[model samples]
Target: MGIQVWFIVLGVGAMTLIVWDGKRRRLKQRALSAAGISHNAHAAGSAPIPDLPFEAMLPPEADTPTATLPVNIECISGGSRIGSATHILGKVIADEPVLIKGRLEGTLIAPNHPVSVTASGHVASYIEGSCVDIDGYMVGTLKANTKATLLSRARLQGVVEAPRLECKAGAWLQIDVAQAASRQSVAMVS
Candidate 1:
């Protein structure tokens, strides 16, 4: 039988021929593990990252590092969120630490700070920050000024630009490394 015949016999959802044997059950687990979304855990509750104003997430410019404005930046805890069905639309900027466990669709700018996307978090936006840690489903651009780390259960898809990108053993990254060659000395231009 041809491929079309098999599809008709089974279903369109069964794209891969697993042979229904014990040898291929592990492949299904690998696919689930990479996305960072656990199929066995579900207890609805509050949101992960609260809905804040666009200006609230912005970092105050200062003459030197370790200095910030008098803006009251709230810190969110991971335990408070339980993968709630909340969706945010717009740009989110933060100067303090951020932990996302819900769905966000927009640009998230948190420079000079740490941004953590948990396994339950699903971000469909551009994320720019100092140190980015992903352990969930992310489908967008990730630009890290310092470093970007993908945990063992992270699943990212899109262009990722950074000086350093580290992926764990079980992390899944569908990306290609790109090096910047625009850093030239002043004397070279002269």
Candidate 2:
């Protein structure tokens, strides 16, 4: 009887410690979030994470083909962005708008939506979208079937072939722009 009682007391103590630890972790997470800090350094990436914002919006789950990070593969309809200071490599196919705020070294295909390279974005590959908005730096081919806009802080060094092109003042564009052929081949197949 005495041994059983000691066992029960030890179990209770362990449970109590677990509960307290859980609470402490929650508080720490809250404090970190409030201070503009993120603790989501779980793994690296090589695929496009759907619906993830570029500013520390870490979804509890993500889907990418890299297999290095635990992410989902379910296609999404909304926009997604690579977070700042993050690095992504591999092909990305999305029907929604995508913003790259970090570094991406692969293809970004948004045939129906736009692909925006924010002021902190660095893309070193091909891009295909309805509209391409460049505010940072991009190297490689940029093909926007509809239009491509270069903001004031844009730095582009590659081939750009879009039906329409617009550039803001102070934008650096060393790429040659040519009129793109009609994109009727990949039109909405409805």
Q: Count the backbone clashes (under 3 Å) in each candidate.
A: 2, 4
Candidate 2 stretches with Cα past 4 Å from truth are 1-77, 181-190
- Candidate 1 total steric clashes: 2
lDDT, candidate 1, 88-158, per-residue tens: 55567786767777876666788888777876777764778898888777765677889998775566655
List TM-score per model, in order. 0.52, 0.54
lDDT of each: 0.59, 0.65
lDDT by residue for model 2 (2-70), tens:
999999999999999999999997986676566443433211221122222233221123243222232
Model 1 scores a TM of 0.52
Worst 10 residues of 1 by lDDT: 181-190
